[model samples]
Target chain A: MTMSHAIEVHGVSKRYGDGPLVLDGIDFYARSGEFVSFVGPSGCGKSTLFNIVTGLLAPSSGRVLVNGVETTGSPSRSIGYVLQKDLLMPWRTIMRNVILGLEVHRVGRAEARRRASALFDAYHLTGHEDAYPGQLSGGMRQRAALMRTMVTDPDIILMDEAYKALDYPLKIQLESELMDTVKAAGKTVVFVTHDIEEAVTLSDRVYVLKAHPGQLVQEIEIDLGTDSHAINERRLASAFNDYYETIWRSIGAGGRTEVAA
Target chain B: MTAFQIEDAQTGAVRTRPARSRNRHPASRRRTLLVFLQVAIVVAFLAVWQWGATGGWISTFLFSSPEQIISVLAQNITTGELWTDMGVTAQEVLIGFAVGAVGGSALGLLLWYSRFVADLSAPFITAIGSIPVLAVAPMMIIWFGTGLVSKVVIVGFSCVIVSLTNAYRGAQRVDPDLLDLMRSFGSSKTQAFTKAIVPGAMSWVVAGLKLNVGFAIIGAVVGEFISSSAGVGHMIVTGSSSFAMNQVLAGVVVVMAMVLAFGLLIDLLERALFRWER
Candidate 1:
């Protein structure tokens, strides 16, 4: 029961106005309903890749396909992007903020409102519809942001370090919940993160990119088993050593010297 | 055994209850006290001024008593002359404000949309804004005559620059992330302007309008002082020339009332327009 590819990037390269290339001939793909993570050091062009994929920036070379449709410099309607910041409109209520994407896409007002309401319970945001973004806790704000992105019903979601702002405990909690939500929704996701454990814990496959003209160094398939709640310390420790060590070595981190082998 | 059971149930209920609300009663009381203190200060100052004038500590001719000003206001009100002059001034101010607000907003949008226009006209606009409206009033009178048109033009001239500068700054200060989000959505230039740029610029626009209300009043009054025959400013001129201190004070009071009323109206409009900001 293999899934079809939801997004495909082939030999994509991006450079800034005759400057050094940021992304160099990167090849990546996410299967339908798959969760994939891109992990690397700072300045590794992970965010650049997310931008190019979402059509915010054009790649210097190569093509991207979304749901088998060729998407070269095309407006990214088929994909939803969640930035690091919640980016909720401070002036809008929680409900209004969640419906912003649908509003932008010109979805009918009534239908957009209907879709936004359906996520309230699922996202644990019930009873706070009229509250402004300022009134929300950080976690609740992020949840509203996720609802905003998901309300568009995009087949693929592009997240650029979306949970990096949360504290460690909250980040872990959110990562697990988000993974469950993405899995249940059956949407493909391409997440960029600096944290290797986060990449491994949430992703079905992780692409390790190298810095300075970022290139895909390795792609590792994660097998975390079917039980979503099986996030035991032992499993995390082992995955950290196996995946983080390899990724670290690729980025010249003295090959796992920081953590026990 | 029954006593222990009851205590255990009570403790369980207390543990299950939600956390106490964070609302502060003392803070609200302090805010009320502060407002009361402000009103008291204003009242005390007005009382002292009135007492000094009436008690002969200050010459009545130089500084009319509050009672005298009030009586003059009442007499003028009963005769309906105050309303006529106020209505005329109000008309000029309203017309000038409308023209200035619309023209300034449109020109600001134009400059925001085109960098060339912004750079080319920056110096000229600055020069015009820097020239005092009083200095330009005589020329305006020569061009438009001692009529409503001259007063309106003067008010518009005084107001347009403030609106333009504030609006331009507002439009230019759009959040980069919001713009990126719009761009990612493939929003057309017009769509982006309507949704992101316009709403973001509204606070500044309202602020400029607030300031321009006072400027508009000044422009109209000064224009009338220089030339007009039928406004509160003209009444002030007649009163001063005749050495009627009470009449001059009455005219001043009317002008102050007009300014205060316009300022309050703008504040109400701001509240309605930017309710989300609260």
Candidate 2:
């Protein structure tokens, strides 16, 4: 039998204490090694869905399956999450911050450092091991934050608009690095971003959601002609604009429908 | 030449002045000048004070000239009497500060952990924290006796409140996002407290220590005033009773120096602790 998808979200819905539905009947899945992104306007509960998937917040209804095993309301050790803010502890050095996950997992200090040090060269933070987070630039700090997640070696990664805080150039640079490393490692990624261009360039598939209940409106498979590892080169593809326009129109239509009602 | 010039030299690169300036920065020069002026003003004031007292223009018995104060200080120093007073006072301040600061910080950590304990103690902390050190010093002397123990108790009482308040505030201000991050990693509550709360609260705790320097000294001196034999406060009381204005002024000078020295110590400690911040 074939291996199951990396993760499956069944009819997940959430509401806060008799309040309006925050998320409605969301079904999502990512096959092994697939890159999936959720894009929407603000207040679409993109973050809420992300939290439900991570098991940080349990859905009011429905369950999650990881590798065909039913797991809901309990975070799997196989998943790693990177938030929008780098959240690197300002008092700790870059290396120490990266090893926080390993320390939490109770990995031996020497082995943890050895494993974490190997990724520093790829993350562009080799010389800054002892330097504190305040000394690093925003992009470098974000990279360190990613390293902190990636060093734990989880099979499934969740990034909530991780590059949204960066400027255009730095965002693209980090995105390219993220794609190269994550794809090379064959990890399943579930990303959330509001930037249509970012979603189209980096994701294998995109899920578009509408706000005020945050239901999935559309899912688009992106084909940029060639499966290139470098995300920067994919921007020039003709189909990139097509995918971008489709997602944009889907969200725009949803906005109009809400306004008219 | 223009006041500013950009000349193309090598590789068609425009060079504006040299890369580094050899002259002193304007701010540094201003700082040096200010220090010189300050010293000159103090010297001028002292010269006038000496002239006024010796020439019978002012009452030496009332005001006491700088020279007279200086001579008394010099005499105490040479006879090793000042050292004894300073040593006694320093012990009280240091011991009291260490006890109060450590205990207060631990109490703050406890409050951070248990909301119930924190809420219970909030009003009592405020009530006890505001009670004046002078108002309580006499009671402290009566309770602990007029020995070194009474002075130490007074000093500790004066300092513990600020330390506790600052530490609690610091712990409260630690970013909630960091705690969430820790939770996502499946870290235990103890891990979060030690890793996030303690280090995050350090700067505020250090600030509390700095503020407590004055509080500690004040407590020790006041306790001495109520009843004591060897402290600088005792020296001041004796000098006042005898109408020796020079000795009184000399004691004031000694207290000022002690405060300055302790302040410098805290500065060094702050630098050592927050090297990462720089």
Give the count of colliding residue pairs in each prediction: 0, 0
Clashes of 1: 0
What are the chain B TM-scores of all models?
0.86, 0.89
Q: Which window of ten consecutive residues has the lowest lDDT sum in model 2 chain A? A: A252-261
Model 2: clashing residue pairs?
A: none
Once superposed on the true structure, which residue ranges of model 1 sit more than 4 Å away at CA? A1-4, A227-240, A253-261, B1-41, B55-57, B109-111
Could you estimate the TM-score for every candidate?
A: 0.87, 0.90
lDDT of every model, 2 decimals: 0.83, 0.89
What value does the lDDT take at residue A120 in candidate 1?
Answer: 94
Lowest summed lDDT across 10 adjacent residues in model 1 chain A is found at A252-261
- The native-contact fractions of the candidates, in order shown, are 0.45, 0.43
Docking class of 1: acceptable
